[model samples]
Target: MNWPAEAAAGCSCAAAVAASFGAPAFRLLSAGLALLLAVAVIPVCAVAVRAENWRANVYNEGLPSHLVAVDKNRQTFLFFEKKSPLKLKYSFPCVTGQLAGDKQELNDLRTPEGIYFVEYKIASGLDFREYGGIAYTLNYPNPVDRLRGKTGHGIWIHSKGFGLVPTRGCVAIGLKEIDMVGPRLTPGTAVVLAERLDESKVPQPDNGTARELRRLMHAWSNAWAARSRKMFDYYDPDSYSKATESFAAFRQNKERLFKSLAFIKIYNREIHALEGPGYWVTWAEQFYTASNLSTEGVRRLYWQRGQDKKFRIVGMEWTPRDVGMRADFQKGRLVAAALPPPATDASAEAPLPPRLDMPEAPGETAASGIPAVPAAVAQAEKLLAVSNPLVPRRAPAPPPAEINWGGRPGMETDREETPPAAKMPSAPETPPVLPEPAPPATPQAPEAPEESMAPEALSLTPETRAALEQAVQGWNTAFAARSLADMAALYDRERYNRLPGVPRGQSYNSVQRDLERRFRAPWLTLISRAPSLELQGTLAVSRCEQLVVAPDGAEQGVRTLWWQREADGNFRIVGSQFKPEELGLAAHYLEDVSNAVSADLEAWRKAWEGGRLDDYMSFYAPDAVQQGRWGAKNIRRQKESLWARTRPTLVQLSGLRLLMDKRGIRADMNQVYADSTGHSDRGTKTLMLRFDGRNWRIQREDWVAQTPQPVGGSPAAPHQNTQRAMP
Candidate 1:
């Protein structure tokens, strides 16, 4: 109980005194510290857990294993697993064609939507850098597309480095993503490309039509084997008439071959059917053998349900195994064989040696004992017989009658009088009993002309000419004002509008969108001269030289506008064409202006990258206007603030196009900006510059954003200075 006892007793007394006085303050401090720790650790813990169990989460979503789905509208490709707990394996951002919609024809510039399978993978020697690092070919125009008459080829899923640029009817992703996903894919991997794919929705195949088509195909093959006329009956008589005057003619042609050959065999394989909007299509590989002659090819048949509720063949196309065979048949071998029967069987029998005058099939050598027919006879047969016997022959219609208006009877009318007007004029009041004409008067001296004659009749009246000039001036003013409403007011509202680069008639909404996009630039100027006005009654053509200046660049061209006089007596632009001046001093001047503007752009970019705020600002004119998220305003303060806060690390420019005219220059380019903070953005930048004696200075600037969001799908907050960087 001596020293140890005394020490324990003293510590107990000290602890009791401290706890009584400091308990309340200490508890509060402890609680504050605990709250701070929870705030910091909870998010980290949640993230860790999510990272560890993401695959499990995916499985819970019930996605099939090894399936990929592309959402074109969302620009995402999702990979799924098909295990006990279906899960999304991976997801990647992707790009599609420049335009949206299901592809319908070649050069439609749209991505296709459907269930497709990877036909094959292309991993090497794909020197085409634009296609990214790897490619997977898809079987587009698969039986369904062929039946719909949709034509195009070479649609693939590929990469274009690390950018998200639109593709030419192909699916695109980053190079790194392609590298990771391409190797995991194999031939026949199912891929569904749709505008959008809801995770909760299930996909179902329409197999009822496919089954019926299979039965039809079997019957077709059996008919060929039996050389029966039932096969011809499957074809719609009206459709068959397009190729032959009647189904009887078609049967007659087939009958000759059926009887001449000892036996006919058709082997069908790889049959596929797809249901379309109003019809269905079937495609199959058909192996044919007539006596000793044998060949293989693809046959496509279009079918539609008739009033009798049965599918009948409506159209047919054949692609031979050998491409040259099509040329040979088109040149008359098939036509000659289908011609009407000769007067006697002797002439027909001579041509029937069971030998085809066709090129040797693949893998066949000259030593093969296959007989060859004479080429001269084949050519003669083609020249003498029509290729399609169904087409009726008829004489052309007679030329139309010609008669002049208000002229002596039987005078030939001009080309414009094809349509006759209502009602005929009564004979002129019996000539009002005119006095007898005197004998031929002596020829008077040729009278001097009142005015020098013009080479061509002047169709434009003074009033019409003045009105056209005024309209053009109004249009020029509206363009300079950068007012979309004012610009639209000059166009005819009732008719479709057309412009340069737009061949098809454009709707008012489309033209309005175009105008809005154009006016988004801060400044625009258009000047025109030497307008030639041609008036034809209510229609007029105004052609002139035009110079356009905008933020993107300047352009010098010849603009021809079609104007129609409205019922209200005002002229409105109905259509227009802009042809860029390609030769002479204008072209040379544009080249010089482009070079100068480009140099200025490079200088500006260098200054920004170098963090020389003063030098960068120097490129702008005193009155330079900038349109951005803050709206059109003076950019001096914004630039100063940006330079104070951050500095640029990298700058990339691409797709630079220049237009130059007498007014100034405009430069449009894609700009990628990276900052020291590791944040990056890509957008389109348009700079309008005017020549300030010694150099080109920016008079206006506009930016349109095209940046991808962060990986987790949340968009980055708008940067104070960069908000206006995108459209």
Candidate 2:
């Protein structure tokens, strides 16, 4: 046997083999050694396989399918791919905040350590040196960070343009590394940021912490669906305040919603738990339906162990987009139908599992401490309640504090994605059997809270008050100028139709016409004074004494206008009501007004028959359009000329009727007229009347001939027929 020179120089083992025995003995010993080495390696490989399986089954199964883990201390970026086994797919060097510890305020230069998600991507408008070419925006000040009173925004994961320099409260990696992982960092991708990566902290499949969190999640959801006041108790007041406008405001808004919604149903599925450095997060696909809306999304709740060692929800986040929860629920139902029934005899069954009646968190405890929630009771409470009684969304009343009814700038609370309006599906006649004890009765409008107990209504800022006054002044200016275009610009046309005293069918166009007639007088003067304003949410109410002076006389009254804060942050007149009693107009019932209108119609007929031109003209409004004539003046002139040409003999009216319409009181009647010229005609006449504070006058008059009626010579000429036919 020959040993290679390199093996002889490098292998003491080769020399030892040669020295230990002769060639034949060495061969036999080598065979025995090989067998022993193979036997040892087999067990080692088996242990490694079991370890991998343990990790997959215990940790990965309890986490989201894909995860982006960033270790600030280690300056490492990790990506767990979306695979059935959820294995780490990539690891790369990264850059974190320049300073140590979590971010606490704006410009803190410290990265936040918590669970967040990629909110969006910034593809353009990049400051190359600062943010690199491409960046994925992370929801920093995530609910947990917000609750902890940590501030700072614009946190992102981006490629590093200036080498691997530390970022200002952000995570940065090499351009090549980012490009490789960019596709997986889409919106709603879970991102776990920690000070250090510690395997010990990873959650196990059925650990105590995970089980307790599940129980808490179930209870919280049940309380919400039940509309129980206990739902609010799950939140840590001190921490929750930092995340919302105020605890009181939050409670008030939620209470209002609970009362307004006839029923609420919340179903959570595919729940997963993740343990961060100090907090634990449980997230799941949530399907929520209320009387007003239905939304499917992912919801995450951050829980922290308090000083008393009890876990409580510090904050929460919701991503409102369909997550197939409904479809999955249907599939689950089908699968459940195929399952075998449970054993009938209780004694024959195995021992029952331990209950999850854990202690509740502090600050929400009753005199009896934490309430017990045994497994049996929890199972009984899991069924959904199905009732959908829609509550009408009213136009917001004027409010002192600015409100975000939908989406307003600077709204404090983060709102889920809600459509402007959702069409509600009719509820099924029979709902699934509810939990043993029924939920609260059908929603009732809660009584207003006592003043002392009511949440403090935020007072409007001076700027808002000034803006409202400016809007009112602008409207007054437009009114005095008689500029219809400018007035239209200041009014929300849709809501403007609801103005008081404005007849139903009358639009802003008619209002403009009426104003034109009012301002027709030469040397007219208008004054508005003593304005008082009140606010309720986006709506503002302004009342002022208004005076109108004309050639004939002066009219004074109080004008009330409702203004709403539009999406553009400007105020516009929505509706207005005038108090005519201030101008000494008598208030009368509908019947009395109808009778008065009838009396006026009769007197007008008499005036025309007696050829009293002045009295006849008096019955028409100053700018009334009569018999296709433009004004009362033109109508009077035409009537006078026609009467002079042929004297009136007789006039009769029958089948008279009066009805109220959008315009005003409208009178319909059959009229018979004959002149000294020995001509007669019969027709149906219509008079559209308007009331000018004191009396009703004809705003419009029309006549339709009932064919030729030969009471005398060759029926009356078409052009000079009935009372209104004096063209």
Candidate 3:
């Protein structure tokens, strides 16, 4: 109590003394008061410093050497590289998902906070501006997330438009930032996201679990190299669920490959193990060779401890290395530091089985007069027989009385009853030529040699049909195998032609190049079904439904191939046509025009909602017509006024239909608009766009309003005065 009272008394005395004194006396009193304040503040500052919190500076000590740390609280992405003095290489402002908080369930719309890695870089030209200029994919819902029961996919790090808007559970930065950093980030680069990042801490890999995991991986590799089927015991066959084939099927397939190849070798490097919830993930570079073929790629294995206290592979994924990564590895710029030693157990050190000998010629026989087929070859044949049935040679069945054209063949029909076949009109009977037959029997008149019957139309024999089917199947298999040379061999290079929407003159060379480019992707597959073939002389036409699955997406369409039989009795594709089942286009002109118009409309909506005034107006032609209450003359001014007073939050277009002619293309669609003030409107929108040999521009736009109706109501009348036209 004495300190507080003494301070108060001294302040009051000093104030009174200063007021009552002259200028010289006041200056002396002020100096004395300043000295007194400094004396009082020193003790208080020392006490505050002693009690201050120091917990924020205690950073995690396990951060990796080279990594990206994202601080959600600060909205910054800091790039760190381990050097003599650890320092941030760069700092970039970043945006997260729409919702703030850690992601949990599917569609939570919240960014996840954890350590992850760049899965891969998306190819250019597949995404829209909404995804910024390009994107780098992230392995969201990774093993850890999945173990925690999280779901959803397609989370990425991308760029945004002009503004740093929210995302759908993805991290986004500016376009410039992506361009500057995209190339530097590669697969396996670490990305750590936290509410706050502490630069003082460095993360280190969990070496204990990593060592155990590496031992398990080496044992598995040793077993493979030794061609030991006992390796299957190491895999938790019952626990594994990600593979497309069952354990038995996988074992059978592997056994076949092992027997077929002369030798198998495996080299592993860049091994990394990440600890997840109740499991561990090990990823590494794998170089494999069988016979004369060699391939290098990245392989990931998810390992989980079983009841027996042994770690077993629960999941696996393999992907070919990216071109850039492969180049770097070849140049020794991205080589691994070191790989763990191979397994030393007696079983793992066992020698590989010898390759099977080729079967002898058909006429060659053993001493016992039986065909000289190796036992291994005989066993492989038996396995193949069980797995794949041989194409049987049999007589072709008669064509159906009436072919069903209502739906695609090989697809189930929803109709309750099958339609009856059309009845063929009875062939008219001709009167018997009895007298002519008797005259012909008189043999004195040498009978004219019977005219050879012309080959019947659509009469393909079973052998020929089987050959055609094999050709088509071969094409499909080649595509699935991603063999560009095999695919090119099936195509008629001399007379290759494609229908509209595809590039013209797609010769064998061009096709091969295209296939090669496509094969570069991590996922590419083509499947065909319900093939119908028609033969005419040496030419054949086959139609089938083709489903193409790629990294970007999947498309199912109808494809027609024209094949010409060569002198060597091989059928080759000469021409082909493909039409997407989603869009029912009447002609080629409408496909591109329709797509362009739809894209333009979407861009306009995006621009308007983003508040980009100049971009919103750029879609319109200079002389575009607009009709409203103020007529067409003040259309721009009216829009400007509306934009100034209100902001558009959402615009959705549905039921879009297009009609194109020589002049332009017309689009009719239903529109729904919502604004920041909670006002909403639904109406029909029509836009007319004209193409000037280069670009398509909006010539006219009309918006018609429909009165809101009660639920289950029949119809609503349009408001006559609500029509607004825009350029």
What's the TM-score of each model vs. the native? 0.29, 0.41, 0.37
lDDT of 1 by residue, 471-546 (tens): 7767767776777888888897655353222235557677778779888876554555546666433356677666
Which model, 1 or 2, shows the larger TM-score? 2
lDDT, candidate 1, at 536:
38
**Candidates sorted by TM-score, best first:** 2, 3, 1
Task: Compute the lDDT of residue 486 as modeled in candidate 3.
Answer: 83
Please give the lDDT score at residue 458 for candidate 2. Answer: 24
Tens digit of lDDT per residue, candidate 3, span 523-592?
4545455477765444566677665655444555787777765567787887767777522111122322
Per-candidate local distance difference test: 0.50, 0.55, 0.51
Candidate order, lDDT descending: 2, 3, 1
Candidate 2 wrongly placed segments (more than 4 Å) = 1-61, 82-85, 198-206, 326-727
lDDT of 3 at 374: 35
Question: Over the stretch 1-727, how does candidate 2's per-residue lDDT look in tens digits?
Answer: 1111210011223223333442222433543543454455664333110000001112543467668888766678988754565667788998776544556677645577667787645554478877777787776766666665566677889986777776667889998887677766755677877766643333334445665565567667767777779888777777766653345545654676677665566676656777654567787777664444344556778788778777877767654443544344333220111111223332211112322112233442335442333333223222211111112222111101101111111112222122222111111122122222222233222222243222222235667667777787777776666666787788777656553323244466676677777656433435565467765433567777665544354455788877766567788876677764232111111223444565566678778888999988899989887545778888878888888788787777643334333334455554667788788775555566666645678878765444332333332232233223442
2 or 3: which has the higher TM-score? 2
